[model samples]
Target: MDPLTPMITTNPFDDDKLREECGIFGVSGADTASAIVALGLHALQHRGQEAAGITSWDGHDFHTHRAMGHVAGNFDRDEVIRGLPGGSACGHVRYSTTGETSLRNVQPLYAELNSGGFAVAHNGNISNAMKVRRELIRRGSIFQSTSDTEVIIHLVATSSYRTLLDKFIDALKQVEGAYSLIVMTPEGMIACRDPLGIRPLVMGKLGDTIMFASETVAFDVVGAEYIRSIDPGELVIVTNSGEIRSHRPFGEVHPRPCIFEHVYFSRPDSIVDGSSVYSVRKAIGAQLAIENPVEADYVIPVPDSGVPAAIGYAQESGIPFELGIIRSHYIGRTFIQPGDKVRHLGVKLKHNANRALIQGKKIVLIDDSIVRGTTSLKIVQMMREAGAAEVHMRIASPPTKHSCFYGVDTPERTKLLAHKLDVGGMQDFIHADSLSFISIDGLYKALGEAKRADGRPQYCDACFTGDYPTTLTDQDDVVVTNQLELLAERVA
Candidate 1:
């Protein structure tokens, strides 16, 4: 077998789920800042698995180390942390939603600017990146990587503002999309969220140190006290002397954080938008039971992500909850499949049916969402093979009818199962006896909202409702064509 053979046999159970975007963690005014950042990134490992990088700024120089794997092997070494000697540091873990998975695309992208050395770790997509890239190239700006994040650096470099802070703000204003950024400069560390707040970022404090991360769970890992979420359009700057200042350059706007954070992306224990993600998921499951009632002998979760919702469903429906599917946490994202004969066994490497518990039982399966519906089909078949008399499927979220352009790695609109089929059609495709999903209104109710407003939704539910908050400039046909032409020219 070739060394890369395992890469071809990725876990089928994970393939059908939405890939997490990326994670960023930053610390300022702390001793051994790089080590603290490493710990924080470890806690946020679920957010991104492809690559990890850390950049630290000492009094004089900026030191950076980037690798094409998880943080453990790369940043855990005492020598590695010792080499990045600084009181301030920032790190990023990437899953490559926008850029290709390679060393160059790993973030905390550093550049030496006219102002000084600057580094940035970003957690969302810049929708106008292609458009801006073309314009920058036309104006003689050179790009070092294919990442959309590099565009921010170019924009900052090209800005005519007299001050570094002004240039940073100017660059942010030109881009259109979700972003929660932690920027490190010689002056200090700056953490900011986009005007819409589509992605999550939280502020925390550990003694005299200030920290910023994609999720609050990272703070908990570093023994930091959760401060509050970085407000939409707000920038918080922490100086080397421990002085902190806040600025809101983008002014006030209707904040629309990603609703799926509660549905799937965030760690269950993390708090998002002032609500516990675990509580919200349980609420969603309860709401699902209230809306779609079905009599079944057992309420079985699809595994990991489905566990919370399944518990809620069991509680609300007065049904017994059981571990009908046993998941193997030891299974890596990829495994060796020697030939076609072993390829079909990929799903079993991650999850296996609880044969004894599910045997002869009429079970209701709970899951977070149905993306392509392939995993659901396989799980349903597996249940039947385990002697399940009847299998009904319940989704905790509304049907994902559209693709997400804000950092999440989702299939194209045409590839989404919900986009192509209705409820009955989906049930038939998955070979389930019955299938139901939570309503859009029910999802909002679970989040403590009365219902989704007709005018402007409080959350970014574009995948389910197709109501994107920002303009997707790169998705424009004309801009895409121009971008291709520019790329071809560069290659030629």
Candidate 2:
């Protein structure tokens, strides 16, 4: 037989689910900062798998290692780890929510400025990046990378502040949007979240080494003791002497962190905002089951991401839980399809119907969210093929009607299935006997809220509610701005 050719297409599973943002990890005052950071980045590989980079400051010089692949592939080598000898380091795993996938855009972006050497690894988009980029260009602020993150460097360089930390604080005041930054300087490390805390960042410690990461899972990876999450607008600096200082540079404001973290982005075993991610997902399912009860023989999950919700749904509805679909662990975002025949197989490559359980059963299928309805449509058909008498689809989240601008790689709103189709239309498009999503209020209840507060929401639900917290300056001009995002690499 001819060798099964590996194919490259976004058709498989990448479109069915929401693409994740980047993950950042940093550690200071460690004997092997680079190696531990590598491990932490490896744990956060799910956040972004496109590229990985780390920058380390070893007192005498700064070392950086950036590669366009998974951390497991590149950072696993001792040779690679040995190249970065330092007592403090910051690293990032890229998923390309902003800039194109290029070596120049890979981050832990290092720049030698008037304040000495500085490196930054960031999570979340700078919504006004273009506006600032334009202003910087006019004033002769030469930028290196295409990423909005580089804008911070220019701001810092141009600031008249006396200290590096002050320059960073002044620079942050000028930018608007969600960000969780892990910045490394020769003096030590500085970590902070945006004023609204739209992205998640946590702090921890392993021995005398201080740690910072986008998620607690990174802390788990490197055996770091869990510390409190970095408060919104709070900045912490770890000095070369291992002494830590805290600063609240931004003015008082109610922080609204991203709600989607509980819905999908975070690891199930991880704890976020003092709540267990797994428990929250289960609660979401229970709420979904209560609001949308159905007569079904089995509660089946879409697998992996959907399992917790399915379990909760089963417990709440008194329906037996069954693994109706078995997912293949090998399925990845990108793979080489043999040809059109394999490409057409679609959901089968990633998931398959457990015919023995699915056959002759009326099933309620639980999924975290329906991004495009492509996978749902295919999975419903698969159940029918397996002799399922009926398939009732239950979504754990409210309808994802709007594209995310904070960092997630969401398709255009016009392309969102929920944006164009009402609930009835969505049910019909997916060809399910019945379909219902958890209400916005129901979703809030799952997160321990009585109901969603319209006046001052607990979290950013812009993707579901279209209630954006910050102004989208770079996104206002769709054509010219999107062109700038796609074509522009740097400003000089």
Candidate 3:
């Protein structure tokens, strides 16, 4: 297949939701390091579901295993883990936001550098990857994969710095955007986060072994003690002999971690940025209730992602909480949609309204966010079909008016419902009796802030506020290229 051509997965039911970026896990100073990394990746499966890969340095040689699917089917087998014999290993689970969904893009992307063998597992987007790629190509750097992650490897390979650590830091300095990376080399394992820290990464320990993962919840899965988050712009290196070192190659800068993790991306059980995700979500729902109270008989969640907030909303609004929608846990991720008829019935296969419970009831539906508004409209229509007297919609997060350049796979600015429509217009489009979203200030309040401060808010709320923390050099280049093409067309 052509590397430039995108291989799109058609899932009508999930298309309206923002796609997860990726997950990374690493372990050093353990005999069964690859096995432990597999367990950590299993716990972080929600972050990415399309593909998984692991790379291990077994004393003298590097061993790698990669597949296009979930961690269970590919990595759980005894034979697979035994093949990756090493004391240090790093793994990645990926959902393609910057590359095609293929085996070639599955990472823990590895290379044989002049210094030694290097493998990297990254969990974020590089905003300036294309600009750097063009420059590298001009300088005779041959790229093996179309993934932006591969750009880091090439940069490190071509750097003029004398030491591997300095070369790694040099490569990082040229890139823009979020990254939480776990890198494995012959000498040691290196874990680091980008300067602005738009993504999340945490450290943990089990006996003498040190582990790194995208979330603390991964540590819990593998029976590791939570250490702490890898600080923004900080690099932690664990040597072959268990000696550890810390470096801050990037100077001090205010961190701006992604705020959406609390709203939707992260598992509720995970702790992010020293805050419980479940607690933050519940607080967000309570804030939503205070800002948009309504007369309703029952408060219902959209299910799974919306449950914690729904409970908080019901408690705050003095309404009974009920599971008005039931989700089918048996539905497989690869369930086939034979045709348009089957595709249109996809929502029913996954979620069905509780007709008996919701009949003749005034219900309020709580959801994380509205992307295209298609899912919200269908859900509201389903509630009405179940004999709901009234259906009101409440969103836990503020309007997602802008596209995310940092890792998340969001629809374009024009495709987002909030970007094109106001609150009233969105309500009309969804056919909801009432529609409301938590104000940006209310969202911050839920996170224990009075409100969002004037400039440089506490977190990276770029998707909601259109205030990107990094320079989008790639996106800017695309805009310029498009303008040039249009001008050439006019002249022709």
Off by over 4 Å in 3: 1-9, 97-100
What lDDT score belongs to each candidate, Candidate 1 first? 0.89, 0.88, 0.90
Best by TM-score: 3
Which clashing pairs does model 1 show?
A: none
Question: Residue-pair clashes per candidate, as listed?
Answer: 0, 3, 0
Q: How well is each residue in 98-121 modelled by candidate 1, as lDDT tens digits?
A: 323468778899999999999999
List TM-score per model, in order: 0.94, 0.94, 0.97
Order of all candidates by TM-score, from best down to worst?
A: 3, 1, 2
TM-score of 3: 0.97
Pairing residues by index, what is the TM-score of model 1? 0.94
Candidate with more favorable, higher lDDT: 1 or 2: 1
Distance from true location, Cα of 354 in model 1, Å: 1.0
Best-performing candidate as measured by lDDT: 3
Candidates 1 and 3, the one with greater TM-score:
3
lDDT of 3: 0.90
For candidate 3, write residues 295-406 as lDDT tens digits: 9999999988999999999999999999999999877667775587677677787889999999999999999999999889889999999999999999999999999888
